[model samples]
Target chain A: MKDRISALVFIALGIFFLIGALRMPRTTEYGKYGAPGIVPAFFSIMVVLLCFIMLVRKQRSNSESSSTPAEVKRAENRRLLLASAMFLAYVFLLGKINFIVLTSVFLSVTSMVFLRKRFILTVTISVAVTVGIYYLFSRVFLLPLP
Target chain B: MYTVKVFFESIASTLSNPVLLFHLSWSTLLGILVGILPGLTATLGVAILTTLTFGFPPEIAIPMLLCVYIGAIYGGSRTAIVLNIPGTPANAATTVDGFPLARSGMAGFALNVATIMSGIGSIVGAIFIVSLAPALGALALKFGSWEFAILAIFGTIIAGSLTAPKDPLKGWIAGFLGLMIAMIGLDEIVSFPRYTFGNIQLYGGISLLPVLVGVYGVPEILTSLKRVTKAEVVLDFSKSERKLSYLETIKKNALNLLRSGIIGVFIGVIPGVGEDVAAWVAYDAAKRMSKEPEKFGKGSIEGLTAAETANNACVGGAIIPVLTLAVPGSAPAAVLLAAMWIHGIKAGPLLPIQHPEMIGYVAGSFVIATILMVVFGLLVTRLFLKILLVPTEILMPIIFVLCVVGTYVLNGRLFDVWVMLLFGLLGYFMRINDFPAAPFVLGFILGPMADTNIRRALMLKNGDISPFFTRPISLVLIIAITLVVLSKYLPKKRGEKR
Candidate 1:
């Protein structure tokens, strides 16, 4: 099922790129072969062909029987979804908030989610990491933070 | 003689600089720590360091990256020996003989043997780089656009095929997708936009650094969060015997060390095939050639030595193609190549002519890094054990922050951060679905080269495409690509027949 989904995603991406490439100027001052879109067109075509092959192969294999227990899968999915949501929120809120405060909050929340117990330890470590990174980049490396 | 002279001169030059040596010690130590962590890989180590060191001078930055590269590959063996978990993919084979040796109370001996073997392997690989890179670069000067275009295709195709042997098609799809992604910005030849959607940020195209961090870093953080397994140190290093008995074992297996080192370098020279594959191949070969084959996986020193040596040697091997062709020999080398570009150093056929000292400098850095790796490997065995005890839940959040900082610092753009996040999710999806990321990266690196050259080859020939097949080097590369694709399928077809 995962393979099939991936195959469909890839195929869609390939077709999208192929259409985009086709719409671009196909001839340049250099010649027909020097078209700016030629390479992209070729790559998109290859992607579509290869993904079709993969889709076919996945269908034929019929080996989607997962050995992972349902409970374990559910737990894994929950962790994944939670972590992903936190990451998305962190990126979205990055520049809007102060680097230190935002990062500390983000890290503290993630640590709490994953570490579960030990709230004090998680929050402390999160603040420490945020400050440590802040100092290391700004003071030591002289690199700017977002 | 010229290579030898330059090698020593470069080493002498670097040693004379106290600041460079200081950088080397810290970076190499940091690399070892990165390697000892289970989910963090050498590629991620190099990628993060590449971003952090973006402002440093090329001389300082490049060597630091090399130290991290060499040290990370060697460091992974520690967790392999102690915890039966390969800290990095490169050390997977080491666990077979390594953990069993630990189980048999020879963990200290195995660790010592692996350190010595890693040092030897790196030295051998560096020697090859000093000798072979110049020759290969000279030969590359003969290659025209036709050859380069075909070579780009060949590298991506072969990388995809080998990196994901179980499903080469998925690898190919990933590689092509990378190539297509490389087309997103304005067309290089003309100013016509390709896929930017009229956004000013997209005009610059997606930066490689953010993509790299996203693809390698984010997935590691997410996947590590999902894994619940915890590892404990099998034995304390100080309590185990730290005698010179392992040196005697190494001395007896000198032939195995040399063979494995050669195997590692050869594997490294192949674009996109990294240390993990080299270690496995060397281990398998050593087992076949072993006097006591049954001793393998049952605490054989020879097996441990073979795996460690090849993987380290592969580091040097992987750099060969990077220096000569600008096509990375491994995933980490790909990052190293990008770091070089970021530093305004152009690698490939013109490298020898443009930066003649670079080949020697790299070889010297590899040698120095190997010595430091060995020294630190022996000196800090206990420290690594403590590091191994750090809970992943705490460690990963810090790493993810570093990843974000690393990505954002590259261009100071929030858009790049979004790119990193998207790619990270894509990378995780690809990982779960069994698609390899190495070929995608290789394709991205080679995309411009392939795009510009194929068109240039056509223009030079007045729209004729025949030369891509007819040219000598192009023909060889074409045949190689065809063989790589067929090798993946023909065997399966034969199996089905059976």
Candidate 2:
């Protein structure tokens, strides 16, 4: 079932990219051989072909079976969804808020989700790590961290 | 003769430099820490360090990165022995025998054997690099644009095939998807924008560092968080009995060490194949050759040594192609190649002519890093065990923040951060679906080379595609690629028929 879903996703992606490649300029100053889209078009087509083969093979295979209990699967899904949401929030809000404040909150929240028992310890460690990283990057390594 | 002289000179110069020595000590130590941590891989460690070391001079930065690379590969053995969890994928073979040894109260002895064998393996690999890289570089100089294009394609296909042995189709899809991702920026030959979607940032193409950090780093953090498990250390190293017979064991296994080291170097030289494969292959060969085959996985010292030795030796093997062909021998070597480009050191056939000292310098750095790894491995076995006690929940969040910061600092653009996130999510999705990310990365690195050279070859030949087949090196590579695909495909067909 997972293979089937992934195959469908890849097939969709390949088709999308193939259209994008087809729409790219056909000729460049170097001539038809040096067109901007040729390589991408070739690879996009290859992707589509391979994914189709995968979809066919997966349809025939009946070996995939899930052994995990439903409750465990649900718990794992919840963790994945929560972690992903946190990651998305962190990346999108990185520049809108102060680097240190935003990063500390992100880290603290993630630690809390995973640790589940130590709120104060998680917050303290998160803040300390954020500040230390900020200093290390901006002051020591001389990289400007936004 | 000149290569030998240059190798000695490079080693002597590195030994004399106080700054290099200082960097080497800390970096190798940090690498061990990274390796011992379950979710942090050698590739991630090297990728993140590449970003952090962007400000340093090439001399300092390159050696520091090499130390991390070598140290991380060796460090994974600790967790494999004590916790029954391989710290990095390269140490997966180590756990087969290492944990049983720990279970038998010989954890200290197993670790000592691993350290000694790893150092010896690295020395053997470094010797090969010093001796063979120049010849390979000279050979690469004969390659034309067609050969390069075909070589890039061959690399992506073989990487995909080997990395995803069960289903070569998925591997090919992942590799080609990476090639598609590499097409997002302006065309190299004509400067015509390909897939910018009206975004100005896409004009520069997707930055390799952000993509690297995202693909390797993000999936690790997310997966570790999703399935948080506490790993128990099986034995206290200080409490374990130290058998003085370990030295005798090492002496007896001299031939095993040499054979595994050679096997590792050969595997590493193969494009896209990494240390994990080397370890497994070497371990298998040792088991087959051993007089006591039944004792193999049940606390066999020979098995542990072969695994550890080959994986470390593979580090040296991986660097050879990177220096000679601008093609990485493994995933981490791919990042190292990118880092070298960022340092204004173009690595390829022209590298030897342009920068004669670099190959020797890299070989010297490997030797130094290997020595440091053994010294530290012997001294701080207990400290590493304590690190295993750190909860994954806390450690992962910190690593996540570093990934974000590492991506952002590259160009200080939030755009690159977004790119990293995008690839991270994709990488995680692909991981859950059993698609190998290594082939994707290899394809991405080689994408531009494939695009530019194939086009240039076509233009040079007046749009006649026959040269891709007619050219000697191109013809050989084409045949090799076909054989590799058939080797995977035909076996599956035969299995299905049964």
Candidate 3:
């Protein structure tokens, strides 16, 4: 189901590019450069044609690549979801927390989760490392950070 | 009369800028340090330095940043040769033979040879940046919208498909996805916004920093999320780790150095492509020509030397397009563009007439930086090798944090924060599905250039697409793109009964 949805998303995107080309204004200059729509029109065609090719290829491929053990597939999906959520959460919090705070927190928390390490060691090391590095960027470089 | 005096003055200006010299040397050493360290890379080194250089004088900033670029590319080979791991993606090819040589007990020799060859390659590349850039810059004055549009399309398609040889179609798909994402922001040239959806922040278009971090860095962390069961630095339990003598290795592979250097320079001169491609291509070429192809994988010094030298040479090659046409030669070169913008020295069509000898200054700086890389590389050899011992669990998070902070700092806006998170999560998901990020970056970098130029070209052509075929450059590129696509699908001749 997910694979089908991904394909549909690509096809829809191709349609979007094609429509954009249609709405674009006609070219005004014509001496040496040629038409304005020349590039976009071609690329839009590329998008749609490539998507269709992908769909055909996907269907023709051996089914075994996708038909892995059910248990392994489920675990894989879960891991992907978890990773995505962590990233999403990190991005959302950056503005609210400010740059230094957010970076330091993200570093510590992520270290713990990814390494499967003990929370105490991860947090302590992450905080020290993050703070030190942030100092180097901010103090040494004098480039402003949020 | 005026031209001669101005030329002499530009030379005089470069010599007079002693403060710039100090900054170049110090920053180059910093860049070498950053590149030699495993967790840090040439791109990150530039990104970190870009912000710092923001406040420096233009003369100081440009030279310093270029120095960092040269130094980092040279330094990257250190980790690649000593450890099995690459310090940067461009250095990845180096490990195919570098670590093997290290395992054979030739780490010191490999490192020294790579540094010397890299310096030589960089010098060759810088010559073009100085001389060829002016020639190209002058020619760029004749370029119009049509040329730009075709160039952008060719850039995305060629780079995307080439990177993903396993499935070139997937590469094009990724490029399209990037173009769509780029489209999400308000249109820059026409001012008729397509995907802004009335959000004020979206009106300006997607910022480069977040996309760069999310696509390149976040996915890296996600892919490496699994904990290694063994301790850090996978122990090489080999019996014969012979350290080769530095001078002996140099005498043995002098031709290899010159060969790799020339290849590296040529690759760097092309707009858009950069060091990663150069290193891989040079290594392949070196091995194909070597007497013993089998030695390439088993710690062959020639392989290690070729990869490092080619990538380092790319620094000079990258500068050619950048100084001449304002088109960056590589991914990090895009970031360098922003730095140039901040300096208020326009690098496009008018660059030659406006600041003619600036190219020479760049050439001189690269030479200095390459020297610094060797000096610093050797000095920090022990420290660089030790970095691989650091835990990934501890390292990946720090990189992620830098990415987040980098996005937030772009404007101190909460909106950018959200953008980074959105892309980061999206990027992480893509990694699991085996999607390559390089195409997306290609699209993001070249999309606007493609859009603006294509439109401008069409505007010139009065909506007629035929002119695209008529132009000389466009014709060649179009044929090249078509051939690249067609060749990917061609099946080997069916069981030729030889």
Candidate 4:
């Protein structure tokens, strides 16, 4: 399933690039630098050729290697969903709450959520590092960090 | 006598610059933070900051970039030990051993070891640039398009051969794909249009930024999304005590420092490879050479030391070729080249007369940045580990938003936001397929270098293309490139036999 999907994507992308290349503006430079189309045209062709190679090369695992690729079973769906939620909130909050505040809030919330830390310790460490980073960059480094 | 004047003048100027001092210290801290953050990358930090530093003087600007470069490389191991995610791809090897050590509850010990090695790596890499660069700078006197073509090929081949963990052939295949892609833009010497589709944006060529982000940043996001919270361990700092002295550790592992440093400098001087490859090669060598190879990838202090040290050393190495030939040794250095160009300082072959002071300035700035990285990296390791304690639920979304917003900030255009989303989706998918993204980034970064140089080589002989074989440097590079390709096909042969 995975291999098939990858092959399809590569073929599709190859098409996009090939079309993009052909449509590229015809550029000519003076004094023998040559026309610009040659480079892009070459790249597009290589892309298409490689995509074909990739699709062809998708054989079963090369068993001679000492290590074979393995896919691990994912954890519970709720855990995955919750992790996604936490990350989403962290991002939205960063811009609105101010980068420093958001970062601190994030650090604390994430620590407690992931490590299952106590509240006070979580809050303290998160606030401290965020403040410290802010001070170091904004004040010490005098950077106009956003 | 003239050399002494150049060195002192550069040193004196750097010392007196307040902005340089501030940015040096500040960026080190930021580098650590981004390095510690799983989704945030060192390359991203430098590339993004490239916009902000567009106006700073070249001396200050280059130094600022170095701070992030050093800091980010070291900062990556923080998560490598504490969370095992390896904040940056370069530190992926560190996680092989580092996470095991952290799992053994030696998080502090592992971090401390990483820092000390980082300090050693930076110092040695810097010393290399300071001493050997002037000599090598003179070698550029003999180089031409022939030499440049060979050097870029050498870099592409070595980068591929070294990065793949298990299969050398897979590495070369990816590299060839990159070389082919790099060949897409307009041929440099003759100005013959090669691949530019209809878009003018492409006429400037595929920006390294987009390709790098697509090849690395996106795939990382995709593959990681499913595993974002698995097997995570947040360090309980209160449980761990101060483990080792930085100075003492340095004294014992001086050889690792020197080895990794040499590796870093060599990697850096190459035209297109970067710190990540240097770090891995050094780490692999250190492990193979270690008395107990078994100790590696299990929180072996030496493993963490080798990886961190070598990557940091690459900073100094990346500058050598940039100073002499105007070709950046790595991705960030390529951006550094653009910044230099923006500032009206041409960096390539004519640098001897074009900007005589550049070598000293770049050399001096890197040394200062390395000093700051050590001083700051030591103090911050313990504190950063606590960040690992965050729950995945809360961390991922926040990173998501930053990814979106940061992308938006790039051109203040929604197009970039769309690009970010599209690439993020692509990155996520690539991860699932087991295609390594770093090789792709290496390809994208080196593409223009190969494209322009080969064209120049072809144009020099009016497209005969045969001189590519006759030239010694080009011949060696072609052989290396061939060897890289052949290494991959060997597996197919084995399979056929089976």
lDDT of 2 by residue, B1-498 (tens): 666777788788888888889988989998998888888888888887888899899989998999999888888998899989988889999999999999888888888899899999999889989988999999999999999999989989988888888777778888899888898888889988878888899998998888888888899888888873456688565564855686698898988999999999988998878999899999999999999889998999999989999999999999999999999999889889999999999999999999998888889888888888989999985576687876888898888888888888878899988999999999999998889998899889899999999899989988888988888989999999999898987877799899
lDDT by residue (B109-160, candidate 3, tens digit) is 6677777777777776765566576677777887777677776667667766
- Please give the clash total of every predicted structure, in order: 0, 0, 15, 55
> How far off is residue B71 in model 1, in Å?
1.0
* Per-residue lDDT over B262-335 for candidate 1, one digit per residue giving the tens place of the 0 to 100 score: 99999999888899989999999999999999999988888999999999999999999999999999989999
Model 4, C-alpha of B411: deviation from truth (Å): 4.2
**Could you arrange the candidates by TM-score from highest to lowest?**
2, 1, 3, 4
Worst 10 residues of 3 chain B by lDDT: B226-235
Question: Which residues of candidate 2, in runs, are more than 4 Å off?
Answer: A58-65, B238-244
Candidate 3 per-residue lDDT, tens place, A42-70, comes to 56677777777676654434466467777
Question: How far is B337's C-alpha from truth in model 4 (Å)?
Answer: 3.3
Model 4 global lDDT (CA atoms, 0 to 1): 0.66
Q: Residue by residue across A3-86, what tens digits does model 4's lDDT show?
A: 556666666665665665566444445323344444445655655665566567646564433242243333433444555466
How displaced is residue B144 in candidate 4, in Å?
Answer: 3.8
**Chain A TM-score for each of the predictions:** 0.92, 0.90, 0.76, 0.70
Better of 1 and 2 by DockQ: 2
What is the docking quality class of candidate 1? medium
Error of 2 at B38 (Å): 1.2
Give RMSD (Å) of candidate 4 vs. truth: 5.8
